[model samples]
Target chain A: MITFDKTTKTYDGGVTAVKGVDFTVEKGEIVVLLGPSGCGKTTLLRMVNRLESISDGKIMIDGEDSMSLDSIELRRKIGYVIQSNGLFPNMTIEENVMIVPDLLGWSKKDKKERFKKLMNMISMDSEKFGKRYPHELSGGQQQRIGVIRALAADPPVMLMDEPFGALDPIIREKIQDEFLQIQKEVKKTILFVSHDIDEAIRMADKIVLLRGGELMQYDTPSEMLVRPKSEFVREFFGKDRAIKSLSLHTIRELQDIIGLAEFDEGITDTITINVNHDLRNTLSMLLNQEADQVIVVDDEGNKLGAITIDIVQKYLHFEIKAKPTLVEKG
Target chain B: MDKWLKFLEINAPRIFDLTIEHAILVGAAILVALLIGVPLGIYLTTNDYLAETVLQIASVMLTIPSIALFGVMIPIFSIVNLGIGFVPAFVALVLYAQLPIIRNTYTAIRNVDPEMRDAAIGLGMKPIQRLFRVEIPNAFPVIMAGIRTAVVINIGIGVIAAYIGAGGLGVLITQGITRGDNYLIITGSVAVAILAMIADGFLMWIQKRYTPKSIAN
Candidate 1:
C-alpha cells in the first residue's frame, strides 16, 4: 500500500502545487488522479516516485517512510510511464522493453524470456518488432512498448501519467482495452493520471478528483457518479450523469434478474452481446435492433441470460443495488 | 592554364612536401582542439554560467582576424621559448578551431529532447548513464557537423600559418607572390580548395554512416 499523509508541495516561489493531500492506494487497485491542468494531479503522481519532491508531510510505501529510501532504488521498484512513450530512440523495441530488467542485472536467458512474454502480452510479434526502433513504430505501438517497458522488471507498483494521451480516439480506445486486459493479469498497484473524464471512468478503480491543489472528492467511479460531493465534481462529470453512469455498469451486473426472461427459440435471431459488454453498448444494440431485450452470451457463445430494457432502466434509476464485486472476473 | 601546369610539374616534389606539412598542421590542430573542445562542450551543458562564458570567449576568438591571431600566437609562444615554426601556427589554428567545435557540442547536447531526459531519469538511469546513452547519441550528428565546420575553417586559416614559417601549400603561394608568378599562386590556391572539398566530403560520409538509421529521417 502507498499512503500519503498530508503531503504538500510548495515551490520556491511559495506556490503550493499539492496542498496537504492524503490518500492510500490499496494493492492491485488502479487509482486515477483526475483534474484539469495545473491542479497538481501530475505533481501528486510524481511525488510517489520522488520525481517531484514534497515540501511537507510524508509518503509511506508498504509502511516504510519513502523519503528514507534511496531515490534511485525507490524509482526502480516503481514503473513509470509518461505522455510521450519515452523509448530511447537509439535502442530497438526489444532493448527498450528490457532496459529496466537489464539494469536490474537479469541474466541473458531471463531477459529473453521476459522480452517474449511482454511482446506476446501486447500481441506484438516479438521477432519482427524486437529489432525495430521506436521511430519505426506507430504512436500506439510505441506506447505499448512504453507500458511493457515499465512492466519489464515486474515492479509491484506502476505509475502512468496520461500514457494514452497522444493517440487518436480509435487507437486510444483499443489501447485502453488492451491495457485493461494486461492489468488483470499483472494486478500491479497503479496510480494513473488523466484529464479525460471518460478515460477516468473507464479505467479507474477509484478516482481522486482534485482542483487547484485541493482534493474535491475521493470515491469509486460509481459512487462519484451517483453522489458527487461538490458542484465542481458534478460539473466536471459533465451534464449527462445518467447516461455516463450506464458505462460504469456491464450487462452481467444484473444477472440475478436474468432467469426472469425465457430464452425462447423464436428470439434466437435477436442481437447477442457478451456478458461483459457495458450497459451503454447493450442499450445501443437494443435501439439499433428495435428489440426490447437482447441475448447475452459467455465467451464460448453459450447463451447465459437475456437482458431487457426494463432492467437497464431500473439499474440506471438506482432501483437495483450493484454490489461491488471484482469486475475483472468476467 | 599552360603556365599553371608547367609550374605544377616543375615544383611537384617541393609542393608534395608542403602539402604533407599542410595536412599535418591542420590535422594536429584539429585533433588537439577536439580533445579539448568536445569535453568542454559537454561540460558546458551541465553548467549554464560556464557555458555562457566559454561560448562568449570562443565567439570572440572567431572575430579576430587569422593573421592577427597568428601574430598574437607568435609572441605567446616566443615567451615560452617555442617561438615561430610549427608550434605557433599549430597553436593559432587550434584556437581558431575551438568556436565551431565547442558551439556545436554545446548546442547539440542542449537540443536533445527534454522529454527523453525526463524519461531516462524517471526510469532510474544515473546522470552519467543518461548522458552517454541518450544525450550523446542523439547529439552526435550535430556534433559531427560542428567538427566538419571547424576542420574546413582550419584548412582555410592554415594557409596563413605559412607566414609564421610553417611549411604548407601556402609556401608555394607565398613564394609565387614574392616572385610575381601568378601560375604558382593559382596551383597552391587550387590545391588548398580541392583539399577542403575532400575533407568536407569525408566527414559528411562519416556523419551519415554513424547516425542511427531510425533517426536518419
Candidate 2:
C-alpha cells in the first residue's frame, strides 16, 4: 500500500537523517522500522506524513506521491501514534479520541458513534470514562486510547512510533498482545518504528533494519533472524537468534512438521499449554517447570497430545535446517 | 485607635471611590497588556531571536523602579500634550505588566509538552487550529497566572498613579505625607493591600475556572 522510492531526509548543515531508503509496505501488513537511536527510523516514518519534510526522492502512498497532496490532507488520511500516547490533556477521553473526526467536521452524532465504537474496541466503557481526562487513565489505557484515537477516522494507513514504549515491561507485553488482537480486526497498513528487537519480531510482518540512516536489510522477521544478510544484522538480532526465531513459529507448526509425543496419563506432575502458544514460550515453560512433558490442548481444551523438551529441540533442529534451503530455492 | 476608626469612618466614602479608580486603572492596564503581551508572546514562541530580544527587553523594563517607569512615561506621553494624569499612569502600568504576562505566556506556549505539539501536527491540525485548540488551551493556566501577577503588581503600583493626579488611593498617602496625617496614609496603604488581595483572589478563581480540568491538579 505504501512504497518508499529512495526516500531521504536531510536537515540543515549537510546532515542526512535518512539516506536514500527504499522499501514497500504491503496492504494490511505491519512493516516495522527497526534500528538503534539516531538510525533515522523515526525520521523515515515522519516523512510519510510530511511531518519531517522529504528532501530527496518520493514516498508513494496508494499510488499517489505524498508531496503531491496537501500536507494536512495527507496527514488526516493517515493515523499517527507516538511513544508518549499524546492525548490532549485539556480534552476529555471522548474529545481526545474524536479529534480527527472533529477536524473532519463530522456531525456530533457521527463523532459520538465513532467515539463509542473506538472506546468499545479497547474494551473501555464509553459512559464510564467518556468525560474523564487523559491523566485519569493508566498508562496502558491511555496508550490504548492513543491507538484507537488514530484509528478514530478509520484511515487506511498508520504510522506508530513505539506506541507502547513508555509502559513497564509486563504492561508493555500485555498491551502489545492486545494491540495485535486489535490489528486482527482492523488490518491497517502500518509503518511502525521500534527500537525493541523483540517487539519488531512479534509485531512486524516485515522488518526494515537500518544503521546510521542506511537500510541494513528488509525481510520477514524469520528470514532476517535465520539468514542475516550482514554481520551487523546478525549482531543486531544477537547470539540467541536461533532461540529468538522460535517466537515466530507456533506449536501448530511444530506439530505439523513432526507430530507430538505420546501423553502419559500417569505423569501427574505436568502442565497444559494451548495449541496456539509459540514454541519459544513452550520451550521456556518446559525448562521452567522441569516436567517430563506438557499436555497440549486445542481451543476447546481437547488434549491433542503431550510435548517434551526433546520434541521441541527436534522441531527446532528441523526448522533451522529445513527452512533456509526452502527459502533459498524459492 | 479611636482616632483611626473616626478617620476611617469619615473618609470611607472617599476611600471607596479611590479604590474603584485604583481598580479601573489596574484592570484596564491588565486587559490591554493581555491584548498585546499574549499575542506577542505567542508570536515570540515562533521566532527565537524575537523571543530572546523581547523577553530581554521586558526583563530590563521590569527592573526599572515602578516610580522610575512612571517618571519616564511622563516625558514620553507629555510630547503628545497630555502626560500628567491617567494616560501616563495607564501606559506605565501596561509597560510594567508586560514582563510577567509576556514572559509567562511565551514560556507556557513554548514549553507546551513538545509531544503534544508533535501529535497536533501529526494529526493534521492546521497551524491556526493547533494554536487555538491545542497550544493556547494548554497554555491557559500559565497565561492566567501571568495576568494575575500583572494585575496584583499593577494594583499596588496604581497607588503611585495618584502622584501624577490619576486619582487613586495614593492621593491620601501622598497628601497625608505632605500634611503629616498618619490616618490617611494608613487608610490608603491598607485599602490598596485589600484591593490587591481581592483582585488576586478573583483572578485565581478565573484561572481555576478556565484551566483545562485535565491538568488542573
Candidate 3:
C-alpha cells in the first residue's frame, strides 16, 4: 500500500501544487487522481515514484518511507507510464519492453521469456514486432507496449499519467477497454491520473477528485456520482450525473428486479442484452429498440433475466438500493 | 595546354610530395579538433553559461582571417621554439575547425527530445547511461555533419599552411604566383578542390552508415 501523509509541494516561486494532500492506495486497486490542470493531480502521481519531490510530508510505500530509499531504486520498483508512450526510438519493440528487466540485470533467458509473455499479453506478434523500431508501430500499439514494459518487471504499483490522453477518441476507447482487460489479470495497485471524467468513472476503483491543489472528494465512482460532496464536484462531473452513474453499474446489479419481468406467452424478440453489459448501454439499447422490456442473456445465449424501463428508473431514482460492484470480473 | 603539361612534368614529383604533406597537415588538424571539440560541445550542453561563453570564443576565432590566424600561430609556436613549420600550420587549421565541430555537437545534443530524456530518467537509468545509450546515438548524425564541414574547410585552409613552410598543394600555388605562372596555380587550385570534395563525400558516407535506422529519416 502507498500512503500519503500530509504531502505538500511548493514550486520554486512559492506556487503550491499539492497542499498537504493525504490518501492511501490499497493493493490490487486502481485509484484515479481526477482534476483540472494545475490541480496537482500529475504532481501527486509523480510524487509516488519520486519524479516530483514533496516539499513537506511523508510518502510511505508498504510501511517504508519512500524518501529513505534510493530514488532510482524506488522508481524501478514502481511502474511508470506517460502520455507520450516514451519508447526509445532507437530501440526495438522487444528491447523497449525489456528495458526495466534488463536494467535489473535479469538473465538472458529470463528477459527473453518476459519479453515473449508481454508481447503475447498485448496480442502483438513477438517475432514480427520484436525487431521493429518503436516508430514502426502505430500510436495505440506503441502505448500498449508502453504499458506492458512497465508490467514486464512486475512492479506492484503502476503510475500512469494520462496514458491514453494522446490517442484519438475511437482509439482511446479501444485502448482503455483493452487495458481494463489487462488490469483484471495483473491486479497491480495502480495510481492513474486523468482529466477526463468519463475515463475516471470507467476505470477507477476509487476516484480522488482535486481542485486548486486541494482534495475535493475521495470516494468510489458510484459514491461520487450519487453524493457529490460539493457543487464544484457536481459541475466538474458535468450535468450528466445520471447518465455517467449508469456506466458504473452492470445489468447483474439489477438481478433483484429480474423477477418483476412478465413473460408474455407467445412473444419473442430476437434482440437481447448481455448480462455483462453496463446499464448505460442497456438503457441505450432499450430506447433504440423501442422495447418496454429486454431479455438479458449470458455469454452462451442463456436467457438470465429481463430489464424493463421501470426497473432502470427505480434504480436511478434510488427507489432500490444495490451494493456497487466497482469492478467487473471477466 | 602545353604550358600546363610542361608545368606538371617539371613539378610532378614535387607536386606529389606536396599533396601528401597537405593531406597530413589537414588530416592531423581535423583529428585534433574532433578530439577536443566534440567533447567540449557535449559538455557545453550541460552548462548554459559555459556553452555561451565558449561558443562566443569559437565564433570569434572563426571570424579571424585564416591567413592572419596562421600569422598569429607562427609567433606563438616560435615562442615555444617550434618556429614556422607544420606545427604552426596544424595548430592554426585545428583552431579554424573548432567552430563547426563544437557548434554542431552542442546543437545536436540539445536537439534530443526532452520527453525521451524524461523517459530515460523515469526508467531508472543512471546519468551516464542516459548520455551514452540515449543522447549520444540521437546526436550522432548532426555531430558527424559538423565534422564533415570542418574537414572540408580544413582542407582549404591547409593550402595556406604552405606560406609558413608547411608543404601541400599550396606549395605549387605559392611557387606559381612567385614565378607568375598561371598554369601552376591552376593545377594546384584544382587538386585542392578535388581533395575537399572527396573528403566531404567520404564523411557523408560514414554519417549515413552510423545513423540509427529508427531515426534515419
Candidate 4:
C-alpha cells in the first residue's frame, strides 16, 4: 500500500510539474495515472519510487514515510519497468532477470530457480533463452524479460511507465493480458502511467485522472466513464463512454442481471464464448455478423444460453441509467 | 634487389633488436595513456564544460606534428635533466596517444543508452557498479577501437623518436639517410609497417575476445 499526502514536485526553474496531490493505493490494486502529455501523471508515478523527488508533503509506503528510508534501499524494494523495456544488451536474458538477486548475493541455485520461474510466468522457454542476449529475442520477448526482471526480487510494489508502449498493437494487447494474469497471482501494489484511455480502462483497478499537474478525478474506470466529474474528463473519455464502460462488465454480470438469451438449436451457424468474456467484445461479436447464434459457456464447458445484440444494448441502458450506485465489478 | 637483400640478411639481427625496442616504446606509452586518459575521459562526462575544454586541448595536441612535439618535449624535460632520450620520446608518444583514447572513451560512455543507465540506477546499482557492469561493458568495443588507433599511430611516431636518440627501428632510417643507403632505409620502413600491422591485429583479437557477444557483430 502507498499513500500520497499532499505530494508535489517543483523543478529547479520553479516550474511545477505536479502539485498537492493526495491518494491511497490499496494493496494488490493496479492504479493507473492517466492524463495528457505533461499532465504530471508520470511524475506522480515516479514519486512513489522516489525517481522524482517530492518538493513538498510526504509519501508513505506501507505506513512508513518514503523520504525517511534510504533512497537506494527504497528503489530496490520497488519493481520498476519503463517504455523501452531497458534490458541490458551486455547481459544474457537470465542475467538481466536475475540482476537484483545477484546484487543481493543470492546463491547460484536460488538464482537459477527464480530465473526458471520468471521465464515460466511469461510462458517463454527458460532453457532456450536463458543464455541468449536481449538482442537475440524479438521485441515482444525482450519486453517480457524486462517485466520479469522487475519482478525478480519479488518486490511488493511495482512502478510501470508504459511498459508495453513500444510493442505493436497485437503484441501490446497480448502482453497486457499476460501481465494481468501475472498480477492475479503476485498481487503487488502497482502504480502505472499511461496515455491510452482504452489501456487504462482495460488494466486499471482505479484510474487517477490528472490535468496540468492537478488531480481531476480518481475513480474506477466504470464510474469515470459513466459519470465524468468535469468537462475535461468527459472530453478525455469522449462520447462513446457508454460503449467504453461495457468493457468493464462481463457476460456473467449481464447474465446474472438480465439472464442470457435462450439457446436456439435450429441455427446452423453458432459460436461459443466463455462466460467471463467482456460485454464490449461480446457485443462486437454480435455486431460483426460472424454467426447466427452466440452461446455463452461456463468454465466447465457447460452450454449456458445464447446472447444477442439486443441483450447487450438492454444491459448498457440498464447499467447507465437504471443502476443507482457504483458496484465494483472486478 | 640483391644489394638490398644482402643488407637485410646482414642487418637482420640488428633489425630484430630495433623492432623489439620500437614495440616496447610504443606499448609503454599507450599503456600509460590509457591509464590516465580513460579515467579522465570518464570524469569529463560529468561536466559538459570540462569535457569540451579537455577534448579541445587533446585535439590540439594531436594536430601538432609528432617530431615537433618530440622537440618541444626536449626543452620542457631539460629542466628535469631528462632531455633528448627515451624520457622525452616516451612523453611525446604518450601525449600523441591521448586524443584518440580520451575522445573515444568519453564518446562511448556518454553515448551509452540513457534507458540502460536508468534501469541500472533503478535496479539499485551503485554508481561504480553501474560503471563497470553496465556502462564500461557497453562501451568496450569503441574503447578498444580507440586503443588500437593510438597504438598503431604511436608505432609510426616512435620511429621519429629515433631522431632524439631513442633507439628503435627509426635509427636505421636516419643512419641510412645520412650514408645514402636506400636499402637500409627500405628495411626500416618495411619493418615498421609489419610491426604496426601485427600490433593492430593483436588488439583486434583482444577486442573480439572481450566484447559482449550480443553486440559483437
Candidate 5:
C-alpha cells in the first residue's frame, strides 16, 4: 500500500506540477490515475516509487516512510513501465527485462525461469523475442517488453505511465487486454497513468480522476462511468456515456412492445448485435444485414431489445445540444 | 618498393626513436583530454548554467594557432624551467585534441533519450550507475568518433612537434625542410600518412567491437 499525505512538488521554475495532494493505493488494487495532458497524473505516479521526490509531504509505502528507504532498494521492489516503453538501447530484449534481477544478483537458473514466465505472461515467447534487440522490435512489441520487464522481477508494486501510448490502435487494445489479464494473475498493486479516458475506463479497477494534479474523484470504473463526479470527467467520456447507458439498460427496458412472432431470424446469427455491444459494431451489423431493425440481447442469449435507425441516430448524436452533464462542486 | 626499403633502412632507427617520443607526448595528451575534458564535457552537459559556456571555451581553443600556442608556451615554460622540447609540443597537441573529445562526448551523452534516463532511474539505478552503465554505453559511438578525429589531427600535428626538438616524423620533415632535402620530406610525409592510416583502422575496429547490442541486430 502507498499513501501520499498533502504531497506538493513545485518545479524550480515555479511550475506547480502537484499541489498538496492526498491519496492512497491499497495493496493489489489496480488504480488508474486519469487526467488530460499537463494534469500531473504522471508526477503523482512517480512519487509512489520516489522517482520524483515529494518536496513538501510524506509518502509511505508498505508502512515505511518512502524517505527512510534506500532509493535503489525501494525502486527495485516496484515495476515501472514508463510511457514510450523506454527500453535501454544498449541491451537485448532479454537483458533489458533482466536488468532488475541482474542488479539483485539472482542466479542464472532463477533468472532464466523468471524470464520465461514473464514473457509468457505478456504473450511474448522467449524463443521469438528474447534474442532480439530493442531496435529490432516494432513499437507494440517494445511496449510488450516494457510491460513484462517491469513484472520480470515480480515486484509487489507496479507503475505504468501510458505504457502503450506509442502503439497503434489495434495493438494498443490487444496489449491493454493482455496487460489486464496479466494483472489479474500477478495481482501487483498497480498505478497506471493515462490521458485517455477510455483506457482509464477500460483498465482501471478504481479510477482516480486528476486535473491540475488534484484528485477529482476516485471510484470504481462502473461508478465513474455511470456517475462522473465532475464536468471534466463527464466531458472526457466524450458524449459516449449516455449512449453507453443503452449498454447498461436491460434489453427489456428498450425493447419494443411486440408479439414474439413479429421478430425475424434472418440475421440473428450474423447481423444483429447485443445491447452491450457498441453503436459502431451494431451499425456494422445493420449495414451487413441490410435490415431495418436489429435484435439486441444480454450477455446471455435472451432477448433484450431491438435497435432501429432512430436508436443509431441517437447514439451517433447528430443533435449536438441534447447532451448529459456531470456537476462538480468544490 | 626499393625506395620504401631504402627509406626504411636509412630512417628506421630514427623513426623508431621518434615514434616512442611522439607516442609518449600524444598519448599523454589524449589521456589528459579524456581524463579532464571528457568528464568535464559530461559534467557541463548536465549543468545548464555552464554547458554553453564550457562549449564556447572548447571551440575557442580550436581557434588558437597551434604554432602560436607552442610559441606562447615557450615563454611560460622558460619561466617554469619546463623547457621547450617535448613539454611545449605535448602541451600544444593536447590543447588541440581536447575539443573533439569534449564535443563528441557532450553531444552523445546529451542526445541520449531522456526517457531512457528516466527508465533507468525508475528501475532503481542511482545516478552514478546510470551514467556508467546506461549513458556511457549509449553515447560511446559519438565519443569514439571524437577520439578518431583527435587521433588523426594529432598525427598531422606531430610533424610540427620537431620544431621544438620533440622529434618524430615531424623531425624528419622539419630537418628536410631546412636542409632543402626532397627525399627526407617525402619519406616523413609517407611515414606520417601510414601512421594515420594504421591508427584510423585500429580505432575503427574498437568501434565495431564495442557497439552496443541494443543499437544493432
Candidate 6:
C-alpha cells in the first residue's frame, strides 16, 4: 500500500507541480493517475519513485516513509515503465531484461532464469528475441521489452507513465489486455498514468483525476465518469462520456434495458438476462435476446417492472429524478 | 666512410631501437591511462557537481608545454636516480593522455538517452551496476575514438622526454643537433614519425574492432 499525505512540490518562484496530493494505491489494485496534459499526473507518478522529490508531506510505502530508503535502492525495488519504452539502444533484448538482476549482483544462472521468465510472461520468445538488440525489434515488441524489463525483478510495486500512449490503437489495446492479464497473475500494486480516460475506466480499480497538480477526483472510474466533481473533469472525460459509461457496464449488463419492446403473456410469461447487471446495457440485451420485453428485478430477484423498448428509451433519455437507479434494484 | 655516412651507419640500429622504445612507452601510457581514466570518466558523467571541475583540470594539465611539465614532476618525487627514468616519463604521458580519453568517456556516457538511463534505473539497476553493465559498455565506441586520438598524440610527444636523459629517438635528435650531425637528426626524426603512424594504425584497428558492426548501415 502507498499513500500520499498532502504531498506537494513547488519549484523555484513557487510553481507548484503538485499541491497537497492525498491518495492511496491499494494493494493488488491498478490505480490510474489520469488527467489532461500538464495536469501533473506524470509528476505524481514520478513522485512515488522519487524521480522528483516532494516539497512537503510524506509518501509511505506500506508503513515506511518513501524518503527513508536510498533513492537508487527504492527505484530498483519498484518497476517503472514509460511511454517510449526507453530501451538502452546498445543492449540486446535479453541484456535489457536482465539489467536489474545484473545490478543486484544475481548470478549468471539467476539472471538467465529471470530473463526467461519475464520473456515468457510478455509473450516474447526468448530464443528469437534474447540476442536481438533493441533496434532490431518493432515498436510493439520493444514496448513489451520495456514492460518486462521493469518486471524482471518482480517487485510488488509498479509505476507506468503513459505506457500505451505511443502505440497504434490495435497494438495499444492488445498490450492493455495483456497487461490486465499479467496484473491478474502477478497481483503487484500498480500505479498507471495516462491522459486517456477510457483507458483509466478500463484499467483502474481507483482513478485519480488531477488538474494543475491538484487532486480533482479520486474514485472508481464508474463513479468518476457518472458523477464528476467539477466541470474540468466532465470536459476532460470529453464528448464520449456516455459511450465510456457503457464500456464499464458491458452488453451483458444492458441486456435488460433495450428501448421499447411489446410483451406477451405466455402463461407465466418469459424474460431473459439475469437480475444482477448494470442498467446501462438494458437496451442491447433486449435487442439481442429478441424478447419483446424483459422483466426488471429487484434485490431479491423479484420482478419489479418489465423493460421494453419504450421503457428503456425512457430510462435512457430521462434522468431518474429520484436517484441513480441500479437496474438490478429496479 | 665520410662524416655523414659514418654517422648514419653507426646510429642506424640505435635509431631502430629508439622507435621501438618510444612505441612501447606510448602504448604503456595509453593502457595505464585507460585503466584509471575510464572509471573516472564514468564517475564524472553520473556525478555532475565535479564533472566540469575534473574535466577542466585534466584539460589544463594536458595543454601545458610537455618539457616544462615533465621538468616539474622531476623534483616532486626525487625519481631521477631510482631506476624511475622511463617510468616517470610514462607517468607524465599517462596523465597527459587522460584529458582526451576521460572527456570522451564522460561525453559518450552522458550523451546516452536519459530515457535509457531511466529505463535502466526503472528496471532495478543500482548506480554502480548500471555504470559498468550499461553505461560504460554503451559509451565504449566514442570513448575508444577519443583514446585513439590521445594515443597518437602521446606517441608524437613521448619522444620529447629524451631531452632529460629519458632515452628514445629524441636523444638522437637532440644529440645530433648539439654535435653538428644531420644524419642523426634524419634518423631520429624518421623513427618518431614511423612510430606515430604505426601507433595510429593500431589505435584505429582497436577503434574499428570495438565500433558496433551494426552501425555501418
Each prediction's DockQ against the real complex: 0.78, 0.92, 0.78, 0.82, 0.67, 0.34
Which window of 10 residues has the lowest lDDT sum in candidate 2 chain B? B66-75
- Ten contiguous residues minimizing lDDT sum, candidate 6 chain B: B208-217
Q: Please give the distance, in angstroms, between residue B164's alpha carbon in candidate 2 and its true position after superposition.
A: 1.4
C-alpha DockQ for predicted model 4 = 0.82
Best by TM-score: 4
lDDT of each residue in B93-143, candidate 2, tens digit only: 999999999999999999999999999999999999999999999999999
Residues A1-330 of candidate 2 have per-residue lDDT tens digits of 999999988999899998999889999999999998999999999999998999998999999999899999999999999999989999999999999999999999999998888888888999999999999899999999999999999999999999989999999999899889989999999999999999999999999999999999999999998888887898888878788889998999989989998899888887789999999999999988767669999999999999888899998777774676334622
Candidate 6 error regions (>4 Å): A68-73, A103-114, A259-330, B1-12, B46-50, B60-92, B172-190, B208-217
True contacts kept of 2: 0.94
Q: Candidate 1 lDDT, tens digit per residue, A191-228?
A: 99999988999999999999999889999998887677
TM-score, every prediction: 0.93, 0.96, 0.93, 0.97, 0.86, 0.78
Model 1 segments more than 4 A misplaced: A258-269, A288-293, A304-308, A320-330, B1-6
Candidate 4 C-alpha lDDT tens digits along A189-256:
99999999989999999999999999999999988987777789988998787788888999999999
Query: lDDT of candidate 2 vs native?
Result: 0.91
Better of 3 and 5 by DockQ: 3
- By lDDT, the candidates rank as 4, 2, 1, 3, 5, 6
Task: Give the residue spans of candidate 3 off by over 4 A.
Answer: A258-269, A290-294, A305-308, A319-330, B1-14
Best by DockQ, which number? 2
lDDT of 6 by residue, B68-132 (tens): 87787677647555333687788789999999988999899898778877777666566776776
For candidate 3, list the clashing residue pairs, or say none: none
What residue runs in model 4 are displaced by over 4 Å at the alpha carbon? A323-330
Off by over 4 Å in 5: A245-330, B1-9, B16-21, B78-81, B213-217
Model 2's CAPRI class is high
TM-score of 3: 0.93
iRMS of candidate 6, Å: 2.3
Angstrom error of the Cα, residue B122, model 5: value is 0.6
Q: How many backbone clashes are present in model 3?
A: 0
- The worst-scoring run of ten residues by lDDT in candidate 4 chain A lies at A321-330
